[model samples]
Target chain A: MPNIKELEDLTTQVRRDILRMVHKVNSGHPGGSLGCAEFFVSLYQEIMDRNEGFDMDGKGEDLFFLSNGHISPVYYSVLARSGYFSVDELNTFRLIDSRLQGHPTTHEGLPGIRIASGSLGQGMSVAIGAAQAKKLNNDDHLVYSLHGDGELQEGQNWEAIMYASAKKVDNLISAIDLNGQQIDGSTDDVLPMGSIKGKFEAFGWTVIDIEEGNNIEAVLKGMAEAKSLTGKGKPVCVLLHTIMGNGVDFMMHTHAWHGKAPNDEQLEIGLNQNAETLGDY
Target chain B: MKTYTYKEKKDTRSGFGAGLAELGRTNPNVVALCADLIGSLKMNQFIDENPERFFQIGIAEANMMGIAAGLTIGGKIPFTGTFANFSTGRVYDQIRQSIAYSGKNVKICASHAGLTLGEDGATHQILEDIGLMKMLPGMVVINPCDYNQTKAATIAIAEHDGPVYLRFGRPSVPIFTPADQKFEIGKAIQLTEGTDVTIVATGHLVWEALEASKALHEAGISAEVINIHTIKPLDDKAILDSVAKTGCIVTAEEHNHLGGLGESVARVLAQHRPTPQEFVATNDTFGESGTPAQLMDKYGLNSAAIEKAVKKVLKRK
Candidate 1:
């Protein structure tokens, strides 16, 4: 497992991967992917209790589900860097006949993905299901899931939210990427969801707020604390307040780069902000 | 000519419940989830016996679908029970992405299908479920004809390794098929054989086709009755072989004419045989509040309609 400094280097490299992969394709989301680099790095590097190889049925191990799958750039990067698949495979992101789809999917036999998720609000339900399965199997290892804050407007999330607590699915930790943006505009402008933490609390969830989501140390500490709350008869929810685009100066605090890729010049500037660390694919 | 008869009547949903209860006793990996339709889908026995294995999803059909897909991760074969409309149209994308495209081994058990979902009107009656399910890639679509066949299908799908849509209805129709009969997915059953016209049917309409065959026999006509249980991965060879001998065909179903079993048969005919055919289905219309018998007759999904279609197709031949 990587230390805080080493994890920071890996997080920088993931940002580079996101920018490069999306730039080569001239399409694919970059903003949310960039923002989630620290969380993904902290998760794969230090958080999850993973096994050696990949199988469809992830038994006796902690599993992760990405509810907001448009950020495949970050997911594919961390998955590759963590040795689920070849790091070189990141070059084929969203190309023809590639396992790296525009959204995260298990359809192409991707090693890290257990379910397909690009259609919003479905992941919470899937995560709850997996958590229930762990209970049925008597596997004590927990299930972790990440969702976009704006994706909560989809209504299915509330249904899953109500179900997880009602059924006492305590072996699960669901994290929300509070980047405050969507494809159209800021979530406030698009569709305001007032007091997300209050909403989860009212729905009977043990809410954990990570105020500095981009900060590596803060994320690791927050997630560890969230993990401690597991198996105590309530599903945990982490409100990670992250920037829309954390690494790049120009992309931050705006939703313009939510799904747009950087140009060749913008790519160089973005890459310069975070120097090559652990090498690129 | 061969004749068929039923001494008792039972709803196909009860067959699903019986099969689920049997699976609970036999297969440890089988789990049941219902969207507040436990009573309607007849899942009470399974829930009663295996309280831990059954998940009462409480009316959220979309969440039920996604959860069913997720349960497959740890090798749990989740069977989701709901109304046909909620099972298909209400959660099409969830099924498409989570179960179908992801290739999860989940059995989507749907009850109250087609116009036979009496008195609920068009809102609950799902006449287009077969079309919606069949269009998805790698989705096995099954519409069983009676109680015995439906029960057999419910148990059989758990053994099959892929996503399947098992469609049945609410009406307590005649129990004609054998109770111990082996339900083979994608295989059509030949109920009666003749040389003049082929009468193909599914779900509740299978009995109607058999009745039409008996009527046709009395009217100096020989109609071959074929029970098409599986809609997609259709038994094209059986249909082609029968049409080759009969020179015409009549497709009967409790679904709409568009994108239903009739259209699938027509596509096979157009590509292979191009035989003259008539459809005994709702003519691109919605069903209304009425008894199952009244709706079946009004929507042209009864034995008399099948008889009329056989006569019409024979004239074209």
Candidate 2:
């Protein structure tokens, strides 16, 4: 396994990929992508028990689904960096006919994506189903999924939440990026969901909170604990308290960059802040 | 005229249940999911036979669709059962993104389709399901005629590779088709031959079209009858060939005239043959509380309606 320094370097590199990809397209989302760099790096490079190659039916291997798929920039970077595809393919992000769509999808046969999810709140149900499939196949493997905290307002997530515990689906771990920011404004100002932790607990889930979601070590540890909590008669949820845009100083602490791409000057500043640890695509 | 008969009658939902039960014993990869309508969809037989393969996803149709799509990730063929309204309209976005767009192999078996759902009113009866499903790029829209055909179509779709929407009704229709007929997707069944006017019908209307043919024969009009089981990937050749012989056509279905099988046949004819066609379907309106037979007659979805349409089209020809 990679040490703390190597993992942090990978996260920084992934942040760079996220910024550069969005900058090139002038359309893709960058805020949520930057916020999820550390978690994606830690999960793919450290946490997940993945197989050597990719297949639609990921038998006998841990599966991951990206519920909040607007963060495709970070997902594509981490997938490419982890050898699912060439990192150079990140250059094709959001171009016509490219596998890397603005949102993640299996439509173009993108190697890592199992479902199309730009429409939020459907991922938890999908994760539960995959976990159930693992049980039916008698394959001792877990299924992991990622979602946005603001996305829980979609109503379908509650159905899945109420269901996962009722059915005792114990082989699934879902992480919500509690960035607290959405397109219009902060989640609090838009529509408060009272308490996410309380909500999951009330729904009978095993909830874990990562105080520093942007920190690679914290994300790794939180996810590890999440894995340990599986197979205990309830689904697992990790509330990751992350900044909307973590690496760049200007983009941080605001919802303006939720779907907007960085201009040339802003892109330069963002790139300079996160020095290229691994070479650029 | 070619005559048809049936010794017994059964609801098409029961056929779906019987087919699912048979699949449980044969196809180990086949799994079933229902959104709190086991009795309504007649899925108890399958659930009883393979309890492990059945997922009772209580009252949450959107989650059921998403779960069915996810179940396909591990190479499992998930057949989601629900009322037609909840199956298509309530979860269209879920089906479009997860199953149809992602190209997941899920069989969305919907029961109690069209006005024959009866007494539940417009809220439960979905007339726009075929149009909604066929609008998705890769979705296969199928509406079988009777119990035998519904069962065969259900089993046949398991061998198919992508998303499919199998539509059946709640009423007990006559079982005229053979017991061991080979079910073919996208292939239309030519029930009878004629030369004056062609009557093409689907779902509950196929049996009515055959009856219409008999009445038209008695009226000295040779009306050809065709059963269009699959609506999308429509059997254009069958419609075109029959229309080539017969000058005019009458399209019938248990759905609205706007986006039902009639509109599909009109598109094919407008492009290829430009034949004069009359639609025997409900106008853009909602159904009210009534018995199945009462609703059929009220909405003009019976054999008498088809006969009237055939006569009208014959006059135009």
Q: Model 2's CAPRI class?
A: high
Q: For candidate 1, lDDT tens digit of each residue in B1-317? A: 88988899999999999999999999999999999988999999999999999999998999999999889989899999999999999999899988898898999999999988889799999889999999999999999999999999999999999999999999898999998999899999999989999999999999988888898899999989999999988999999999989999999988988999999999999998889999988888888999988888787889998888887887898
For each candidate in turn, give its C-alpha RMSD to the true structure in angstroms: 0.8, 0.8
Model 2: residue A160 alpha-carbon error in angstroms = 0.4
Question: In model 1, which regions exceed 4 Å deviation?
Answer: none
Instruction: Report the poorest 10 consecutive residues by lDDT, candidate 1 chain A.
Output: A1-10
Cα error, candidate 1, residue A157 (Å) = 0.5
- Give Cα-based local distance difference scores for all models: 0.93, 0.93
lDDT of 2 by residue, A1-281 (tens): 55999999999999999999999989988999999999999999999999998988899899999999899999999999999999989999999989999999998888888999999888888888888898999988999999998999999999999999999999999999999999999999999989999999999999999999999888988999999999999999999999999999999999999999999999999999999999999
Residue pairs with backbone atoms closer than 3 Å in model 1 (clashes): none
Show the lowest summed lDDT stretch of 10 residues, model 2 chain B: B308-317
Q: Count the backbone clashes (under 3 Å) in each candidate.
A: 0, 0
Candidate 2 docking DockQ: 0.84
- TM-scores of chain B alone in all candidate structures, in the order given: 0.99, 0.99
